[model samples]
Target: MSNSHYDTSFKGLCYVNRVRMVKPSKSDPYRAVTLSVKSGKRVSTEGKGDKPEFTIPLDCKVVGAQAQAIFDQILEEHWDDKKPPVISAAFEVGDIYPDYYVGTRDKNAGKTVPILKGRLLKLHDVYVKGERIDTPVETADASDADTPAAAQPETASAETREDRTVDAVAEEAASFPSVVRLSKDDPDFEERKARLKAEGYRWDRENKAWRRPAA
Candidate 1:
């Protein structure tokens, strides 16, 4: 696909299940490595439940210093824990493209697979056996849940609290940004409320907020 056809940035926590160096082929002069990754919010699941997995092929020849550091860390974890590392990476697809293949031994011989041609922009974190250890990104927001109320602004009005909550919740719902809390007094609230409940939003009667997991 063209560069404009794909998203500018791709972010996810990919659990590496396996890694191996690929021998150079006639079409490609340099060797490469394939990272078999499980798609999930976190690798702690150990690839359990309903998460899907895929293989991302990265050229090892030009992985650069940053990518090499992450690869080295992953190799260390693999050797010590005998388990693959969970790597969080942000990817761009400007130079990356899909490659079609056809082989007798291949399951989907005629299908195409996306070959990551761009260098790894950043290695956000690494996990061993589902436990996070190394992280390069700021995690302050993650600790907000445990922050003391006294540390926050107490002078903010109720309307301000409601507005902030709505904005925060809206940003979290990247896929379903239309999701919102409706009051019981609204004419169609009862009808739509039931559907939201079934979809996993929990009604917080005390706070008057309907919350679901962030996107």
Candidate 2:
């Protein structure tokens, strides 16, 4: 709302651009405006290589200019990549910058390790795995077969019928499934193999989850 917000020449003021911003400590939320960045780059330290974002440490005074510099450096590094500008760091709070004050180090000295800034500027929507938070699609609906509506009373009771179905299946496997103990090379082996093949079962090396090989 002030003129300095527009006047970007003030060195070291860092800000996420006109991106949907969320505060980590939601007890006090900041109003989103076009963020201004400054000179240096942010650092990352995550292992899974999570898309980096900015985070204010629990006990630190992050100067606006310092944050801006790091944010600008990150953006400049990826300016021509043709993808959404992203910070190339693993996932962790420390991934944004060093535990110590990295800003104090003189650039004239032996080049210090550059920090990886995260892309906290553009948060358009939130997702869990691949599903959107609002208007969530049911996982059962994601399957090829239609999820049959389980029978329930018009006037419901406290009992959970869904749990009952699972319990019933488990009980059947525990009790009656042992009746026919046949190895993989039984007379019905061909039929079983054909059924498994039809189901598109394949061995997954990374995760033991059986899946059809990608086409």
Candidate 3:
């Protein structure tokens, strides 16, 4: 399949579980961490009552310096805790793919099932047990701080600054739109469609636009 067709991004609220650091091995020499994330929604049944909440399990590998630092702290703080930490975050995952395997035991001994997998790319607005964990921010080095303003990099031009200010205003104005309109002739249609889907936008055929209910 073409790479463009693959859903390369996903974002949602999930329960981060089973935090473990993987030691370097012959097969994979890099040090890494794994997180068992469960994300989904509850559905209602007509007259039968509410059906069980369906969840997609993603065994995602946590990589990159920022994400590793966050998980490293989590490991250090809760390594001895019996229960996994209750974590909620607006997170993003990338390089998603499906892995299929045969059932080894119980109900369907020989049945094949698929598991969704991805790499944990980012975690935002994270909270652990109702308390927020502030994401670390990068700061200038002490040496750079001591440098005079003249030694610092040149600032943006007035035109460029104005454009950026306008962009910031526009972005802030539309925090989350109720609908996203797209056309088949649009150059970035597929890319935008994939992104909108990841952001919980569903196609509204009647309205001829992608719609996401107000949260």
Model 3 ranges off by over 4 Å: 1-7, 23-25, 29-52, 103-111, 138-215
lDDT per residue, candidate 1, 108-154, as tens digits? 56655444443333345565555566742332221132444446557
Candidate 3: pairs in clash? none
Best by lDDT, which number?
A: 3
Q: Write the per-residue lDDT of candidate 3 for residues 1-215, one digit (tens) a residue.
A: 12233326777766676555344555542223334454345567888544336556676776433554455445534434566667766667777788977999998589997787776766777778768887745333211334345465658876676554777976864786887787769999779876775564544433456667344
What is the full ranking by TM-score, best candidate first?
3, 1, 2
Which 10-residue span in candidate 2 carries the lowest summed lDDT? 86-95
Q: Which regions of candidate 2 are displaced past 4 Å?
A: 1-98, 101-160, 164-215
CA shift of 211, model 1, Å: 52
Highest-TM-score candidate: 3
User: Model 2 reaches what TM-score against the true structure?
Assistant: 0.17
Cα error, residue 135 of model 2, in Å, equals 13
TM-score of each: 0.37, 0.17, 0.48
lDDT of each: 0.43, 0.32, 0.59
